[model samples]
Target: MHTVDHLETLCARAWPALAEVPLGNWWMRAAEGFTGRANSTLTCGDPGMPIPDALKLVQRFARDHGIKPTAHVVNGSPAESGVEAAGWRVDLDHPGGAESLVMTGPLEKFADGVVESRDLPGWWELTAGSEITTAQRHVLGSGPNVCFASIVVDGVVVAAVRGAVVEDVLHVARLAVRPSHRRQGLARRLMGELAGWGLTQGATTCVLQVAEHNEAAIRLYEELGCTEHHRYRYWIPAVS
Candidate 1:
């Protein structure tokens, strides 16, 4: 029963990656590096560019930046326009299913092994360090006004999940597990911990946004009983 207004606030607070994930700015933080915000439209992987240009832009962006760039096309734009106009084959827009639905619960009910504050910062650091794109890094690392949790194994930090309570809804931000520690159910454990925190923060429910193409992630969410809700159309103007 998460409302659109609530989700938007959650995205703004918890998942700054949606639109605020910093880009081209972090490189400035790095000595001798150049930074630029990810083009939201008309730059590359945008639906308004020519097909060949779109592909090339995508390839170049990924190659140079080490991250996949997505095109947010304006809905209702005729297939003959926008990305379609750009000469790219249209795959029926969202050939994928739908955005995942949100679920709410008491934090106490979800708490298991207990989430500790000592390990939270390190978990954030590791997760942020692993991001390939500046936007991803910003959300996971420097995004403003957020809360988080981390899981430790044998006294060693292994997994982490962060949530931001924005507009009374909890948006799960960065969730990460060490590559060497996969398949141990740590992520689920961390997610449970995050849910607990969300409830305490007055969040009515929790929401997460993931790429439609990420099958593995979608399956994991489904297994966790997360439902599919509405899909959001991501559109970047050819110039904006």
Candidate 2:
């Protein structure tokens, strides 16, 4: 199997969607339109049936959920061409609508401080602040093995990141820094804490997804010794 396929498979398991249904070998995910990752079909391996059948299943699932059907296709995968042939165009309105790079690196690179685990309330307050919606809470708390890592300045949480370990790979997400706390290496510090925690759970590598157009984040990941492992884009049904 390709490295991207492996990484993507691990990612799907690590960051599970709110609801999932099997369409042959594909996974149809829905999360009340929270984000593309949760709302789109995950075309990881062979869809197990004809392209038309798969598309129809996607449509039915979306209709049942009252969401516009979308497919998450890996770049250069056979499913990508199949979906495009079925009149599924890229979802331009979605964040990172074009393509997103999957980055990976050794967990040791960021394995530094001791990572502290927090309950939902503490994690939400530190990372998302107040006024978070129900969907966001569901997504953030979906993972079975998720940990929220933070770096405290004085006594306040200034930098935070989320990590989930699946199949021995650490899937990092939601790395954030307070506006007044940027450019002080807090992001890196958060990564170190999370990675260190992951290592204790038998994780050897780390992976994360970032939009291709996010140069700043891309640069930061690269600086942390992360490299592109794969790319993927979302496909929405073309309107007649």
lDDT of candidate model 2 versus the reference:
0.82
Query: Which residue pairs collide, candidate 2?
Result: none
Q: Per-residue CA lDDT of candidate 2, range 51-145, in tens?
A: 97899889999999878798999989989888999888988778655689999999888688769876545457766668777767777776758
TM-score against native, each model? 0.57, 0.93
Q: Write the per-residue lDDT of candidate 1 for residues 91-202, one digit (tens) a residue.
A: 3333333222333433444444434434354674666653346555555554444665777777666777777766566667457788889998888888776766666667
lDDT per prediction?
A: 0.49, 0.82
lDDT for residue 106 in candidate 2, whole number 0-100: 90
Model 2 weakest lDDT span, ten residues long: 119-128
Q: Using lDDT as the measure, which candidate wins? A: 2
